[model samples]
Target: MTWLVTGGAGYIGAHVVRALLDEGLEPVVIDDLSSGHRGFVPEGVPFVTASILDGGAVEAAIRDHSVTGVIHLAGFKYAGVSVQRPLHTYQQNVTGMATLLAAMADTGVEQIVFSSSAAVFGAVDVDLVTEDVAKNPTSPYGESKLIGEWLLRDQAVATGLRHTSLRYFNVVGSGSSEVYDTSPHNLFPLVFDALLEGRAPRINGTDYPTPDGTCVRDYIHVADLAAAHVAAARRLEAGQPLEPAYNLGSGDGVSVRQIMDAVARVTGIGFEPELSERRPGDPPRIVASGELAARDLDWAMRHSLDDMVRSAWDARRASTP
Candidate 1:
């Protein structure tokens, strides 16, 4: 039984691919190389350079690989960019999910692990968001992901297609020495790049209600997130009934100032962040409660904030040509 990982050449997807391999499972990767890098796909894995929006290609890949399960990770992820390109975000995230589901139905692949985001919750009032919180997405990116999760739920009820949607917060840390760096829209990479370039990293807001005044987010290590994916896959393989959406996060909100402090502590880079006015749609606090994932998948985060920063800094330094 082979597993298909859409966007497997991207940052978190690549780490999930590595975890799949470590578990002795064959992972077939499908990435369009738009935001993903071909080099990130591990050697020996059957990789198909294609977009998930292409239903024909997706169906063919699933059929060709005899794919039994899927890890849907391909989608537009930039929250700010999604606001600017709402149509494009809808096309890539919403349409892409529809196309994949159609292809899965055609190929008789019933199980899926969706890469959802904490964006679905948008600006929640709760400090620790659980799975039952009302979904009030603020951006098109978040809406698209919520739509994907809805589609999965609908499909599961209508067609017996069991699926697990893992709602994640800020996914950080590099899983391998060859860093699969993300775009500048993400906070960690953007800060890392600025620090590396001898410039002060920009802190968008420092007057929020959080203790540090900056936005607070649950930043989970990519490796630990990948481990949760493996556990989800194993649960399905064991014929367990599909559970509700699971939150994969640290259950603690790390402030932007705290992150910068960790970076400086880890890498000895004493560059201070330049505080700026709050960007539009910037949430004050969006921490997650991973109680569901922990109870169901038996997942636990092992990396601390310092550990995450150090691993990311190491990867960033090593990637500099």
Candidate 2:
């Protein structure tokens, strides 16, 4: 089966594309290169350089490639920046999703796997977040993701579309040395950048109500995450029933201090992290249980904390110079 991966040139999307190819499925990519690297896309894979907002390009890609399904991952994904640029966020994420869905409907392509985010469940009071948690997004980025999921649900009802959204938290590590997380706002890249520059990495809000006095988050390996996407696609192609959404979490929380420790241990860079005041709206903890995803999508924490840090660091270092 042929699947079109939106933003396939991006870090996570590239990994997903590789996973699809490994599963013996043809993959086509459409990315605007806004935050994606052209080199990240493997050669010989059909690539269309266009935004999902462009209906003509999107429709043509679907028709020309004979795309059987889609893995939607293109959007403005910075939650903090979305607060300052809400309109831009909505335009890129919400409007882009609508356009993609309309293109799918026009082409009679029914199946889609949306790349949703844990940001949908903002500041959860529960220890382990499930699929049914209250979605109180604190930023336009998170709000846009939730609306994207809604678009899939509404399209399913109206056009008999088969779709599922995979909500994940803090994707880290690299499945291959060629692809690495490049987000400026993500913690992994931030810490790595600081270390490379011979500066101390800053840990924000170390006074949170957690065991380590730092915010705790669930981190999942990108390779494991990519595998789940392939599993979801296979199930959908087989006409198997799937939940509306599934959380790809590790079921274990890692504190910022712990991550710093791992980086020091893996990279052999021994330096104290500069602790700073808590950023506004910083939550104490946000971890989820992947029991549902494990049962259905064969999701599991295949990589440990050090393994995640080491792989990401190695990939990042290899990409430098």
Candidate 3:
């Protein structure tokens, strides 16, 4: 059986593809190269360059590749930027998801592993977020992912589409040196870019009430995340019962200050991060309890903070000219 990995050429998507291959599953890729790189698509993996908004194209990829499932990861993912480009974000995530689901329905593709986000929870009054928390997404990107989950759930009710959404935040590190995090908005790349150019990396705020006086959040390794995705797919394929959604998170999260320290230690660059005023809506902490995920999806923090920084730095440096 083959799996159609939408956005398979992306950073996380490419790692998912590699995991599927390592697990002996045939993987096919469909990416429009919006934020993904064509070089990330491995040789011998059948590739189709197209948007998920194009139902005909999605359907063609599903049918032609004889895909038994889909790992949907293609969408507008920048939370901060989505506020300024709500229309584009909604179109890519909401409307595009609808288009993909339509194509799946048409082609009788039943199983899917949706790449949801922790952003769906937005600001929280509690410390340890769980699946039961009220979903009040603050950004357009988060709202779109929640809507995507709804699409999957609704379709499942209507047509027996086996699905699970993995909600996570701060997906860092590289599973392989070939696939690095390239997002300009991500913390890792921003710090990495600064270090590469012999500049200081700055923290937005450093006076929060955490142990390190900085915001703490889950920072799961990409390989670990990809492993959960594959496990979910296998369970779905085997008709094993699974939850509707699971948080692929670190039970205990790391702080931004801790992360900066790790970057300095890992990259061999020592500099104190300059602190700026806190960005509005930025919470002091946004950690999740992955106890449920650990029980069901074989989820664990296989990489330490230093490991994440080192691996990501290696990949990013290798990719640099």
173-241, model 1: which lDDT tens digit per residue? 888988556777788889888887789988898999888899888889999999898889888878896
RMSD of 1: 1.2
Preferred candidate (TM-score higher): 1 or 3 = 3
lDDT for predicted candidate 3 compared with the true structure: 0.92
**Across residues 120-188, which tens digit of lDDT does each residue of candidate 2 receive?**
998889999999999999899999999999999998999999999999889999999999999999999
TM-score of every model versus the real structure: 0.97, 0.99, 0.99
Model 3, 1-321: lDDT tens digits are 799999999999999999999999999999999899999878999999999998899999988989999999999899999999999999999999999989988988899999999999999989899999999999999999999999999999999899999999999998898899989999999998888888888899888989988899899899999999999999999999999999887878999999998888887788988889898989999999888889888989999999998899999989999
**CA error at residue 109 for candidate 1, angstroms:** 0.8
Lowest lDDT 10-residue stretch of candidate 1:
178-187
Question: Least lDDT summed over 10 consecutive residues: which range in candidate 3?
Answer: 265-274
| lDDT scores in order | 0.89, 0.94, 0.92
Could you give the candidate ranking by lDDT, starting with the highest? Answer: 2, 3, 1
